[model samples]
Every structure is written in structure tokens, then in C-alpha cells.
Target: MDVMEWTGQVYADTPIVSAETYVEAPPARVWELVSDIHLMPELSSELREVAWLDGLTSPGTGHRFAGRSAHDALGSWETISTIVDCEAPRRFTWAVGDPGHPSSVWSFLLQAQGEGTVLEQWAQMGPGPSGLSLAIEAMPDKEQKIVFVRLREFETGMKANLAAIKGLAERRA
Candidate 1:
């Protein structure tokens, strides 16, 4: 058997979701899209908007941003995200809520393969406070189901974002 077995299920035991897509463009082209946090609102299902914070024009390690999101289940909430990793044209990572005690950690990884770039979006849900935390507090026994559902929502959203990125990058190429 494989060392990692993913059966398309996410128990609260596994609070992560990731998706990848290939863009027939150089890493730089794809990077242009992924690193532009402001563009996320157009592609994401839950994120309503994002704006740079602390007078920063672009994200870099230690920079922060505010995001407004709305989900049918979780309703609406705003978060302050702090950039944790920034390697242009390769990777960008950030933590939501608090960098040291985040509700979630998300990353975009770009790898050059042949003439195209493989872009992967990954997210790990909290060990901190979030809507899920409230839900878990209310129904501790259904934690697994709640996490699984949220992860599935994340997977769907990431896939759509990747598709949008691919379309934009290829058209620009």
C-alpha cells in the first residue's frame, strides 16, 4: 500500500485540503496570479475581498492583510492574515487570525515542470479559534463530520480557484 492513503475523506482527524493544477505557462506567469491576494475575491467562493494592511503594496514575509469571507454554514467573518513565507515565483504562505496562533494556514506552491508550472494550493485548518471551533464546542461529537464537510468545501473552492488561475495564465501566455 502507499505510504499515504487519501480516500477522499477528511475526518476531524485530518484537517487539511489541497488541490493542484498545471498551467501551460512559466512559473512567473502563474506566480503573478497566485501572489496577488487582491485577486482572490474574483476566484474564491467564500472570500469576499482582501486588501493589504500596514501600508504594504504587496505581500512579503511579515506582511498582513484583512479578508472578508462569507459561507452559508459559517455565516460571515473577517480575518487578519499574516504572511509567513514569501519566495516569489515559487511559494507563498500565510496564517489567518494570528501568525503565532492561526485559525488556518494556507500556501501556494509553484514548481517548474518542462515548459509549464504546476501550481498547488494547500490549507490546514485550525488548532486555534475559528467557526469550526464554535461548532465543535457546540457539538463536540460531530467534530469529525464538521471538519470533513469544511475540508470538502475547501477542496471545492481551491479547485475552482486553480481553474480560474489556469484560464487567466494561459490566456495571458
Candidate 2:
């Protein structure tokens, strides 16, 4: 697991999807586990591994990371992500390249919630290409339903990931 704060100008104007959860740990401890990009696999069962593609220092802006995630005995997806923002023990953001359906930006924010920590995750998808939009428009109602169904599926996947993180942080206390 190689994690670095992302600092770049290429994607300075991307949107983010933010979701939050409470963990039974202080902000500093939670930050240790979440900030270490390489240790993410150890923190969650769903994360198989995370690697740094570009050699860089830890938790610094503009560091690149890639990781594989699985859906407990069902399937998995591989993403090559680059850190867009890195603010220790607080917030971090990443962008996944050419994710097939839509290019996406992901972010995480951590805050102290009384004796615990509140973790928030956000994702932004789209900036779709012309051809992709055309194809989506050409699809019939049934096909359109399938598309939205898959979008929900992705959202569920994100929820599971967040749950895993929460579980890990809680157990540490």
C-alpha cells in the first residue's frame, strides 16, 4: 500500500461524492489507518492491495496510487487512482482514470464525532463523451433501466467499502 496526498492542476475542477460514517476512534488514530494508502488492504477485507505507481513521499499532494477491490467471493474491480488532494487526518481525494463507464473523482473526509470519528466519502462521475451519451440516448426504456440499475450497484459497492472501513476502525478501539 502506497498512499500520498494528491496535488495537481490537471483535475482542479472535478466534483466529489461525499458520504460519512462514525467510527469508535479518535481522529488521529483513524487518520493513521486511512492515510496510509498501502495499509488499506489490512484495514479492510475488501481491499486486496494498493500500490504506488509513481515513487513519492507519503501523504503528499500529487502522489499516484492503484488498488484492487473485491466483492466477497463474487467479483472485483481494479482502479488506477491518482491523489488529487492530501490533507492528513482530515481529507484526501483521488481520481480514477478511464473507468469505462465514466471518468470519476473520489474523496474522503474525516472529522471528530465526540469520542469517535466521522468518515465521509464522495464520488463524482461523468464528463461523458459524445459517443457514450449518444449510445445512452439510443437505448430503449428497458436498457435505460439496466443502466440505472448498474449505477445503483456501484453505489452499493461504495457503501460496502465504507462499512468495511468503519468496521476496521471500530475494532482497533
The number of the candidate with the highest TM-score is 1
Instruction: Give residue 17's lDDT in candidate 1 (0 to 100).
Output: 75
What tens-digit string does per-residue lDDT give for candidate 1 at 1-173? 11223344433343677889889999999999999998999998889999999999997999999999998888999999999999998999999987887889999999999999999999998766888888878898777677777877788888889999999999999
Query: At residue 43, what lDDT does model 2 achieve?
Result: 48
TM-score per candidate: 0.92, 0.65
Model 2 residue 121 CA deviation in Å: 1.3
Q: Give the TM-score of candidate 2.
A: 0.65
For model 1, how many clashes?
A: 0
